[model samples]
Target: MPIAVYVLGLGIFTQGTSEFMLSGLLPDIAHDLGVSIPDAGLLISAFAIGMVVGAPLLAGATLNWPRRTALAALQSVFIAAHVVGALAPGYGVLFVTRVVSALAYAGFWGVAVAAAVVLVPAEAKAKAVAVVASGLTLATIIGVPAGTLLSQSSGWRTAFWGVAALTLVSLLCSLFAIPGGKVSTDETHTVCAELRAMARPQLWLSYAVTAFAFGAVIVTFSYLATLLTDVTDLSEGWVPALLALFGAGGLIGMAIGGKVAAAYPIRTLVLGAGTLVVASGLLALTAESTAATVVLVFVLGLAGYVTNPVLQSRVFALAPGAPTLVGATNTSAFNVGNALAPALGGMVISAGFGYASVAWVGAALGAVAVPGALWAGHLQYRGPRTGGVVAQGAASQEDPAAARARA
Candidate 1:
């Protein structure tokens, strides 16, 4: 497992860059392909749509496959996708390339998360999950920035080439590193049974909680460059640095979330959501000041990412029956929220409210999420205390117990 996590993380990091680097490359992509910025934006939407639609459907279809096989196959498809994107003849072909590349996000990341849990002893599940999940954070921290620079220096298409190369490395690593084991939950339950897990009201509740929290972050960050240069009045070079700072905070948050969550995941869930609400307000107001803006942006990233590990941990506690599907669907919810936030934030920005307005939109939506967190809290109180008990058992071991609780 030493290299397995790194392998999986690298694979996911490549996928993450392919999926998210578009925002940074949008202008170049638009102008190069003879399309409008809005048209280029659709590429982002297409990738996200692929993820939201693909996670469960792909999981169900590949339900019986071994974990390593499934992951390798998905990443191979992603590599082909980036290659196609690099060599695309026109917008249609490139768009399809994006959709194809995006297909890897949900299934691979989901399987990877489940794999991380199973790869270690029962005590390290949360830590393992965090390590795997860091791929997305690292994409933001390292991949996106590096990809942005690559796009600027060579061309946006070159970034795809880079990601494709990374995927090849990941493929080799997956071949060597992943130990044979069960990654899919559908072996015990039918795909129908797994799909039925979504029918439970708690699943929808989990979706809402995740949807809003992540949505809040994306809405503002989607237009973050606009905010920094236009609103915050920072120079162009400062944008990536600021974005990286946010990612750094996310790195810290992801780690802290795992550590603190063992004691009271339920409380952490609400606290994490609430932090978004307050942080959004602070960011919206302070965005005009360079110093305050930078500090708040870092804090925002920290608080925003803290919810991810906590939310994943909560979903596992609630839906132990199908943790793989649960984890997969939760990832879908994150993108669903991502798909939503910017569109809504766009309407405000379009109305001439200014760049910082997106932050307020994020704030309002985040405020709405707090109540959902509270409702989840009540559900925890009334319903299964099993997760709480397990979390308590986990608390004693912290990371050690996390690895044990994978079952």
Candidate 2:
């Protein structure tokens, strides 16, 4: 809703680009640095590992810093890291640079999400998160492919340079647009206060739902190209376009979900997770049919991303005292899903199950999350009677009408 929220989205677009563009440039990077493809692939893992480690670490370290200052400083660090990465001569240097960039990106994300919600009304928190996260969907459609194209036309280093330049633009936008102040207005903000909020059972339940819900999406996505080619019998050239179609569907889903997630958190979670399960199961059964596969891919993307805003907003709602830390942990939960799903999908594919089996794995993950979502809803309705910080925080934002109806 605010220009600042859009600016945060732009910043995430750049970060997401850097996060995913490596997939397309890995071969070039391996060839240039005289490393094997598998070793170069570790660079992706390095970024993920960095994100998982950096989110909570940097969030706590900078928890007391001004939100705008933290964001701008992190972006500067990201730009510097990318510049160095672009110029690095060897695999080791590039690998280190990836870790550094991911740390900056992770910290920026935690602060940015915390800042975005404070800029809007409690009822609009999910919308604000959706606006910020839409950047990632856009990156999936435009940035990664564009980076791949630039790398193909120039060099992989050129793609890194491009990301650095784009990040500079985002940083400037953030400096000018985001409000200048501490994220928490409370004078007594402390790391211990934040840590204490993490004691809530509902908060941990929400994290599990976050991981399982998103892992369901990523597992199938990680194997989509192979399924498209090997099972659906599509040409290699169609992969990017099909992936873009998936992104297009995600953008649509986010728009729809953002409008209602705050008022209908449980319904949003149930429908989104249920749709993902159904879509993945259908894809698994119909992978041989090209038309069916294409349709299901779009459905999968739509279902997968519709849960994004709910997953994020519910965390902030449940842990109002620790938004920065909660956001950082949620980010870690997301990356955990991202890393684990691909490994699980890879295992399935290697164990003599076909590429389509990844969809079944995805369905199972989604199935696990459905009950978690129901449990979250139950906690929301019943837990407020205990009257702790978690209950107070969650109650502050939950839609009373919807809560009553569910009860």
Candidate 3:
């Protein structure tokens, strides 16, 4: 609950707006750059690729720098990337810019969550992370819709320019607000040490849970507008409003999830994923009714994000020694889900299944995480005996209070 936590959230909002707003601008970008809509859609994939590559790599590469310094530097690069994107002349240039921006964005996210964790008490770590992540929910609520409106009225380039300006503001806020100093020597480690921390089976299971659980959310969200128009009989003008409703549900879910994740991480994961499975199944069955579609979309968003804090906190807890790298890897896992789920959803839609089929895909992905979460919980209860010798050593070195908090 520190002021710095809110500032970090503000910074995340700027970066997230840049990331999510592009989905709304794809049509305008495709027409303006003389490309097909599918081609323009590749920009999303390019960003995800950059995130998966950049998160762990950049976090390890910058392991020696102060967290505050790393965050400021990454935000500067992000702002510059958006400026370039705003001025891009063709599809190739825009695509390259999106990748570059995403690299900086991913690096920022990797460091930012670790930084947030350090700023709060062990008991408040999940809540702090939730505060930072709420920025993304807010982006879906306010930023993406506003950007889409701007693109509709002025030009797609204008949305990019607006993001650049907002990022500059966030950059200034970070410079002034975040405390200055390197991470404690005890928390810092060599590249090999960090790599060793990642060798835990439990850690990988946590990542798997993150990937599939969140992927379920994206499967339906990636084509929500299409679903509304094609099946629910909604007008195009209502898409943004409906998306905002989903974001509202996300905000509510994150608030509730943060409150419970610290004490019941695995239970929260199972319940959250279970909620997604049920919500998605209902959505698939009732997509034709406008009332049902609206209700289910909100429920889907709520259930999908309820696990965010739990997934993030679990990863950090699993690798207590390598917070930065572990946090980055977890971010990468979420993006991996983001990248793969949409492709799967697209395939289902193209195979002659209706838009509602995406919900079934989501349900299956969510279902996969249930057992994964249970297995992780079983591992946690059993201690680190089977988690790999290096990871066990790392966990044994953690503070007793911290370990108890995690339990």
Candidate 4:
């Protein structure tokens, strides 16, 4: 692993903190701005919308720039946006700032992931991505809770200020650490060529695997606090601790996934999603038991995150030429899953299914992804083709010995 990869992870950590910390500060924001809690919650939706729209748009717009320059520019914009958020006069200003910050974050993620892939050997691509993604897991475990605590002790604006400061540091690190050069092959990729690459069925299947697998995980996870308090009879204070435990499990899962995905991408997806189904089903059945709930939460996190590296790596494998655009769109897919799953889970709970029912919803989604994963694997085995000649670009990059060993 290169030092630059870890720097990218730090950049992601700053972004992740800003993204997830909003959940913890919404109440304070609502109170301060004289808005309803639901209105304040819309800040999250604004960020998600920005991500879905900005990922591809910004990525394509900057497709011609050097990777490091794009990353630096995006992070700079993100940091400035957070500073504006920290100093916003009212809810509307904050909302606009959140969307702007998210656009920068989305653009940064696309460029960062594509840059990480370019920085490492093909055999290490998944592991490199996992390293970057661990920053998010770390944020869940530490940053969000810490920001919540800060908001409680000081003010919500203070949390934004802290995030802005951290982002500035991350931007500095990126400027100093990330190599400054165009990806040699990527320079030739015209917008039309990238669009053509994005149109592949295999790539769409890869996106499906990303959306479904992640949506399945979020279905249960989105309502976990309710399940813990209402069903398992845990006190409200225990929720944060248990959530941290879940994140700890995710960190472990991501580390393991990184190692395995380089060799066993298909198996990583299948087994990870399979475990998620089982874990979610058991969670639904045993929600009344505190011990069982605790155990299952960690299992759910583990199973859920283990699929991330596989999904990310698959998108790159499927569209090797359009990695920046495809990777950005894959990030959009994850956000789509994040937005859709919770709404579906909330509907189930509203229908008197109880909080545990979300797990069953998750199980069904995971089941749907099983065949999707297999379909992606089939495409990978078929290999990339152009006209009659097999395009060996991505396939040839893998270590033959590693592939055979996995076989």
Badly placed stretches (over 4 Å) of model 3 are 34-37, 352-354, 383-407
- lDDT at position 378, candidate 3: 67
Alpha carbon lDDT at 398, candidate 3: 45
Candidate whose lDDT is highest: 2
The all-Cα superposition gives candidate 4 an RMSD in Å to the true structure of: 3.8
How do all the candidates rank in terms of lDDT, highest first?
Answer: 2, 3, 4, 1
lDDT of 2 by residue, 1-407 (tens): 89999999999999899987765676578788998544665676678778888898888888878888999999999999999999998999998999999899999888888889789987677778888989998987888778767776798999999999999999999899999988776755578999997777788888899899988987777667557877999875676677777778888888777776766777788899999999999999999999998999899889988888778777876777787789999998887777677667767766788889989999999999999988777767653454222222544455644474542
| lDDT for 17 (candidate 1) | 76
- For all predicted structures, in order, the TM-scores are 0.89, 0.87, 0.90, 0.85
Ranking by TM-score: 3, 1, 2, 4
The residue pairs that clash in candidate 4, if any, are: none
User: For model 2, which pairs clash?
Assistant: none
- Considering lDDT, which of the candidate structures 3 and 4 is the better prediction for this target? 3
Tens digits of per-residue lDDT for model 4, 110-143: 8888788889987777678788888988987788
lDDT of every predicted structure (CA atoms): 0.76, 0.82, 0.80, 0.79
**Candidate 1: residue 158 Cα off by (Å):** 1.6
Q: Which stretches of candidate 1 lie over 4 Å from their true place?
A: 34-38, 185-187, 196-199, 383-407
lDDT of 3: 0.80
Candidate 2 has its poorest 10 consecutive residues by lDDT at 383-392
